[model samples]
Target: MTSMKRVLKLCLGSARGAMVQGGALTVLVLLAGVGLLALSGWFITAAAAAGLAGAGLAFEVFRPSAGVRALALGRTGARYGERLLTHDATLKALVAVRLRLLRGLMSQPLRRLERARAGAALNRLIADVDALDGVTLRLFLPAVAGALTLLVSVIGLAVLVSGTVALWIGAVYGIGALGIGLRFGPQALPVARRAERALQAVRARTNDAFAARADLTVYNALDRQIAHAGHAATELAKARAHRDGIERAAQFWVTATVQLAVAGALGLGFMAVTNGALSAPLAMTGVLAALALSEALMPLARGISEFGRIADSARRVMGDIPETVPELHPRHDAKPMVVPPLDLRSVAIRPLIDTLSLTVEAGEMALLAGPSGVGKTTVLNVIAGLLPPDRGKVCIGGTPLTDHAEEDLRGRLGFVPQRTTVMDGTLMDSLRLGNATLTEAEAWHLLDIVQMAGFAKSRDGLQTRLGSRGNALSGGERRRVALARAIAGRPPVLLMDEPTEGLDEATATAVLKGIRAYLPKSAILIASHRACDRVLATRVITLR
Candidate 1:
């Protein structure tokens, strides 16, 4: 709860001016509404009494009529302004939250990010971020606006009517609002929170179902996945219905409490009239004020009911962020280490790569050979700086790898992992990973080297849109595209993990031939368990 408050404070602090302005407008809108209703009731009663006394023409009706018009216009205009400012502030806060979330994720270790992708983390992240808007729009603003209306209405009644009568009215209305909060607020909170989780579950399952549609169909389990999504949706709907029922009941109780208060006021007004202590017009005004105050207080119950879920969402969003994020500003003084004989001196990774020492000199193609569990890929990761060595050091050009920033190292090394990662974008977009500024001509040249130029040009040229995870292309095609992307910038030291794993024999031979011809002067290290990879290597390092 404390953390939730902290997050709310941070959000409010980001757009304090707009929030405060919107809050002030809301107060004005509520006050205008109450004033309009009270004035209308008093005017009608006063007009009726004057007519009964045969003094209808002598009464001053124009002033009250004009006041009513002014209040109506003011309330409408203020309500519109409040919505505009509040929504604008919310949009700004949304942008801030997204930026912070991206920064937090980027600061985490590569392994953590990789693990997070296998679950529903992305769906939940989006849901939690959007839920924050409700906190500002529904909860905080409405609660504050309702309280202000109550306070001002009570004070006005006390001045217009008798103090004793005002006290009774305040007690009834205040107690009714407080009771609604105490009785239903806590109950609806947990239910609303459960609904949020249920909804997230439904969203996650739906996304998974779509992403794995082909596999599910092939395995004859498409119906099973669809059933799972349906079940999650049913649970979410049930939870929402329960939470809403509690809110409606609370609203009904508030309505009844206000009616009872109005009845009591009418009785008191009759006694005052009989005793010649209060005017009929003023008594009517007091009753109308109670009704207006009830309307203002109604939304408060809904806001309180929603408070718990938004708080829960806030907690989930901030839960994974480190206490302090690493600074991501580009380092002006850092540059990629030039020259190479990529060297790992006595490197040891827990349960893998035990006390390994190796060197891949410039212009040489080195192969990492081992059986299935010998950490061939792990060594490549360590050299690529994705995994920190438990002992010993990795150096390039006699400079320790750790001495260079991660961004700087990215330019000096080209690493293609075992898994293919191709997001939904145009062909040019995916091919520019190694170099953002690469021109279409240069990208096509690289694709031609990997024998994908004809394929890309025949489709949409540089504008070919790939589906999510490059699902539009086959396994071999995706692998070749990834290779083209990695070499687009002509990285001096290449690290590939089973680059030919998914390709046919002829395609794999052409890929190796292209690499040798295009990058003859660059050092290359390939991690593979395939015996066929040995023929292309200048030297093979066989792990025991």
Candidate 2:
């Protein structure tokens, strides 16, 4: 909750003036609506009274009619401007907050980010951040505007009508509004939160069902996966329906309360008119104002219903982020070492590889060849600084691994893991992740090197959108895409775990040749047991 408050403070503090102006406009729009109704009622009642008293011609209609017209037009314009400013400001704030959250997630170690980037972590990106977007519009602004409008209308009634009438009407509204909130606010919160959880489950379950479709089919469990997904969907639907029911029930109470207040005010207005303490027009003004106040109270119903989910989402999201995020790239004054391009000294990861040492210098290709479970990928991780070795030092260009900043390591080194997956973006977007300023010509050149230029051009060229995990492309094409990405900038040190795993001998040889031609000075290391890969290795170090 404190985190949610901080996020709101950040949002409003950043755009205080615009949000304030929008809130004021919201108040004006609602106030004008109330005033318009009251004045219109008074005009009709007074004009009729003047006719009965045989002085209708002497009564002024132009000014009252013109005032009504102005209020109506002004309310419409103010409403439009209010919506535009507030929504625009909220959207801009959402962008900044999302970026902040993304940066926060990236601030974690690469291991965690790698593990969480797919299903659940993605919710933080699309669903969770979006859940809090309505905080200002649905809750804060409407709440302030609603309270102000109600107060101002009650005060107006006191001045323009009987004080006793104003007192009773205000009491009825104030009590009713409080009663409704107190009654449903707590009850609706938990239900709304459950709905949001169910929604997340639906997303995760649906992704799981599709992602493991092959395994499920082979195991004769596809029906069970489908059932799981269907159950999650059903749960989400039920939760949403429950939340809507709560909202509608609250609306019912709000309407009944408003009607009750209007009726009492109308009864009091008749009595006041009979006693001659207030004119018919003035009595009608109070009655109509009481009725118009309903609009101001309407927002409270929605605010109550959404209160739990938005606040929870905000708290959880913001709570994960610290008040200050340290610099992602801490500058290093250390110069590059004149040693091998890749070096590891006495590295150990328990039984995986004890006291292992190796180096791959510039323009050399070192293949780590071993049988399965020989800690092949784990050694690559240590070289990439992804997993710190238990007892040894890893260095890049003579600089200790810990000394290099994230940006520096990424800039100087490239590693393609055994299990590669594509991000949800275009082919160009994936390529640009490696080199942000990469152009179409360069992208095509790299694709041509990987023998994927025809595949890309066959679809939508560089702009072709790949589905989740590159489902849009074949497995071989996806592997090639990862190869192209890893070597996009032609980094000085390249690490590959089965880069040519699925490719035939002919294509693998050509791809390997392209990599060498593109980066002749680079130190390339491969973790492969394939004979085809062993053919071109300048040196092969077989792990025991």
Best by TM-score: 1
- lDDT, candidate 2, residue 368? 93
Count clashing residue pairs in model 2. 0
Candidate 2, residue 380: Cα displacement in angstroms equals: 3.2
> Best candidate per lDDT, number?
2
TM-score of each: 0.87, 0.86
Q: What is the lDDT of candidate 1?
A: 0.82
Question: Which TM-score value belongs to model 1?
Answer: 0.87
Question: lDDT per residue, candidate 2, 383-494, as tens digits?
Answer: 8877778898988887788887777777878899999888879999999888888999999999988889989988999999889789898888899999999899778899
Q: Which stretches of candidate 1 lie over 4 Å from their true place?
A: 109-111, 117-119, 160-162, 165-175, 193-234, 264-274, 331-341, 396-402, 513-523, 531-533
User: Which run of 10 residues does model 1 get worst, by summed lDDT?
Assistant: 117-126
Residue 216's lDDT within candidate 2 is 91
Root-mean-square deviation of Cα positions for candidate 2 versus the true structure, in angstroms: 3.5
